[model samples]
Target: MVTRRDLIRWLAAVPLFASIWPLLRLDDARAAQTPRRVRPGEPGWPTPSDWARLKQQVDGYLIRPESPLELCRESPDNAECLALFRELKNPYFIGDSPVLTQTCEWVGAWRAEPSAYVVAARRVEHVAAAVNFARERNLRVVVRGGGHSYLGTSNAPGSLMIWTRAMNEIRNHDAFVPSGCDGVIPPGPAVSVGAGAIWMHTYEAVTGGVGRYVQGGGCGTVGVAGLIQGGGFGTHSKQFGIASASLLEAEVVTADGAVRVVNARREPDLFWALKGGGGGTFGVVSRLTLRTHELPAVFGLVSCAVVARSDVAYERLLGRFVAFYADSLCNRHWGELATLLPGKRLRIDMSFQGLGKEEVATLWKPFWDWIGLQDDLTMMAAPSIVAGPGRLRWDGTARARFVPGLVVFDDRPGAPDANFFWASNLAEAGHVIHGFDSLWLPAAMLARERQPELVDALMGATRYWLVELHFQKGLAGAPADVIAAGLQTPVNPVVAESFALAIVASEGPPAFDGLTGHEPDVSKAQRDAKLIGLAINELGKVATAGGAYVAESSYFQKDWQAAYWGANYARLLSIKQRYDPHGVFFVRHGVGSEDWSDDGFTRMADSD
Candidate 1:
């Protein structure tokens, strides 16, 4: 039976409730915005004439609000929309009934307004049609692959948004990895992933039939389309590489609304640019062809301590972690060593294909020596490998564990010495722990203290931490200096090219709060300026210390492009212009958007 505490945690984790408690408690507030009933027999779909008329009417390169309302039947119940709604039979997927003022609002306290929200599209032809329609009308377009955009670029206020949620499709092609569970490989290699397929879904297909597919991202909810374009990272990166590296081909709808099949051989430039160039700046991707890899037999692992919060513990734990990861990068076995602050624990997750205890010990000897673990120490070895066909039967709970916001870096070998040149002291200060190190602390602490049984159950269920790493051909050869600096920060060749939207939603916008949790409007500008200055100073310290900043994870864009995409701005723009001549693809904080990009990019550069 689920306990009251579980209920509390579940409530705390709920999307709308977790952030706002008082608002959730108010029944009157809930009653105010009730669900509107959908009218029955609202026309099966749009007729050709309707589609043509709608296309002809939407002229300007902006969100056609009137067209949207007209597309859908006019009624006091729904707002003005285009006649296209009449054609779309899918139910509107929303957390709440009455639409929030801002569709781009994310966790924390920031609320951003997107240009527009296109009703979710399902079919490939529908996607193609939408792109063509948006381009022909000269409307700025942004596709919403999964709506998980941290920077709020997924949905724009006035620009046309093409949602690909309904486009999820997965199939095994005979030409790709063949499907089976004979505990062995087959002759045929097949893989078919739709543009809307999430990481989890793709994982199911790739790892299902005795065949292993290479992808990234631990979270199952992220759309493959966006993740691939944005250089996805995952627990399995060490063995394979980034999800983009595994990509074979992609069906992309260009800025001009022309759909094209692109791969390494066909349109090599676009393919190269797409690998790590980032998302939205390019065109809408309809489907992706992923490359598969072989699964390991026995994934090995170890845990030194429970937590590492103190200076000594931090140094000991983080130093060892840095050394190990540096070495792992050299071996292409992307390992993750996390330091939990709240629980004061240090854990290392390593992956090796079918390795025994002896090999595991030898590989982790450096950490073992650093931490001084004895031969009799508690070491739990499992015959279980995270990959394989049976992994699909792990149950839905396994799927739920996948979470986003997990930060990653390229801290490979020689990173520390290179960081010394830039004075990046994160490696020195021990703040350069993995994503799980920074997060999972508060929650884990609460779990252990509040629910010891549950915590114990999860103590060491798995042996190896899935080490996800993806390296492009030319990418593996980047200069050591740049790699060293980028390793301290998340701004690598892969992550830099994607739209890592970091939404900073505080309880409210910047203002002068006079003790009542509210800011005074009098000194708002000055207060904001001072606060921003302080934040910049802190980031500058991070950058100067050989560590860099990440705007994809942090909502603020202080040193955005430089810190995020590195020197790929010019190349990205060229791709943008070639694919989208009329600027049909537009995004806030995107490649060329001014209102959002101006402050973030400009300020970061000017500060330097």
Candidate 2:
């Protein structure tokens, strides 16, 4: 075993990444004493000279982040602000901005805010320098890669941010073996992605360019490191498994400023914690290597809508779809979302893998025929099942040749042609969230005898807010090997047995703080939030378990530890304490975070 002390020595020996900073050697005795975390203008804050010396250490990569919204605040009608608004809807633009968050704001909670300073990290040394600086000063440090954190863990008003946006570099490997596991683990095809890389670029390199598949987020803009840390799921997760389960190794900068490589062999406990232990909690993962899978022959979508003319008819439609999902659509080939909306509407925006167009159409014929028998149901959309070559599914350059108008490309100056986001995800770009909550829906609800109960729950919930069933987020009907792999992560154990993850939420337009006339309608947002809460409570009656994806859950979630990690919380916390004993890495709801206050600025307990 490579002990943490030995790993530190190894990192120092590497000439390319020698001890960038003297590690903040926190002896066991000193680690027990909690320091009062300070903010800018505080007594314990670092002076200008202190920041300058640290900045020098990173070779001028440090920066002071200024929000683009500042221009909008000064003059709402100005050219720069208007031009900024145009690009605000582009998630690629959002990801690259130091002062922006993919989720602009969550009502009654947090608004996307900038840190006092940002270390625009381009390599492991930059991240280590920032960690060492913040640790010695007892200053709160925030980590933002994709900046898609719904809980605002990645953004804080007066903290230092280790921004990994510039570290995006992707590489495809023919075979990979983790460090110290040459004989213990066999080599296999894999891809090493920088922490800053998004699924869009990853898919393009792995699938489009190399003709192989890698598990990633359905939405292309999600950051690679955060998603894996929080237990990622995608459009075809049932086929392979959660993205975190496929992680073979990670290069992380621990709180102690030691650049360590963790995997199944070296730093085994931290490796396990990184697999589904909430992001921004443990350390800054600079890069990750994931096992890649063979590309399927086809990747397709089935998008259509069914509108019920009456309440009774909607119940029948919901019941039929649920039964169809259990009987045929529960396997690896079927995944993605199907939404049940107000006005008694059923919206199917699902994706499939390894199925032909004709096969998909044939599978849906019986369900469509049943809808035809109902006098109160109307098919609002014709069957639009489109299946194409699997490699083109995420290939921005090649996708348009097959599936037109489904993706919006980044048209900014000097932007890569492959930088684009799914049209379905555009609505989420820079949107002010009203309310969002995700919970796993158990497979037992799909039983023939229990279908009515599930239908009743869905019907009652839609009365309050839109409910989306994300099948790929759960592992109920996945292959046995896939489910077995998923079980190894620290994610909520209930996910392995759930049929789908139900997301009920609402959001508004970009409501940047201090922008007049463009601010979010708080009254309307509060109203919607109440209704969203009601919807989740309705579904909660039959959910049978308390579990929610930490990445897409409520800020007010009461039992977050259990809901996010279930029985794995204790083990994760133990590992957290072992690696980050001095509380250098702190995120809201993260393991060992209960010892600190919500803002991560002060200690709430002593020697927990």
Per-residue lDDT tens digits of candidate 1, residues 236-314? 4544555666666777777655777776557866765666556766777888877666655444334344344354544
Question: What pairs collide in candidate 2?
Answer: none
lDDT of each: 0.43, 0.89
Candidate 1 residue-wise lDDT at 358? 68
Candidate No. with top TM-score = 2
TM-score of every candidate relative to the true structure: 0.56, 0.94
Candidate 2, 1-608: lDDT as tens digits: 88655665676677866445255234423544665799889897889899899889889998888877877776788888888887889998888899888888887898777899999998899999999999998889999999888888879888999999888999999979999999889989899999999888898899887899999899899999999999989889999999999999999999999999999989999999999998888999999999999999998889889999888989989999999999999998989989999899999988998888988999999988888888898989976888888767777767776777888998888998889888889989889888889889999998899999999999999999999999999999999999999999999889999989999989898886557857888998899999999999999999969799999899988899999999999999999988898789999889989889888998876663
Superposing every Cα of model 1 onto the true structure, what RMSD results?
A: 20.6
What is the Cα-based lDDT of residue 11 in candidate 1?
71
> Runs in model 1 with CA error above 4 Å?
1-117, 138-140, 176-190, 300-310, 324-330, 340-354, 361-551, 594-608
Q: Return the top candidate by lDDT.
A: 2
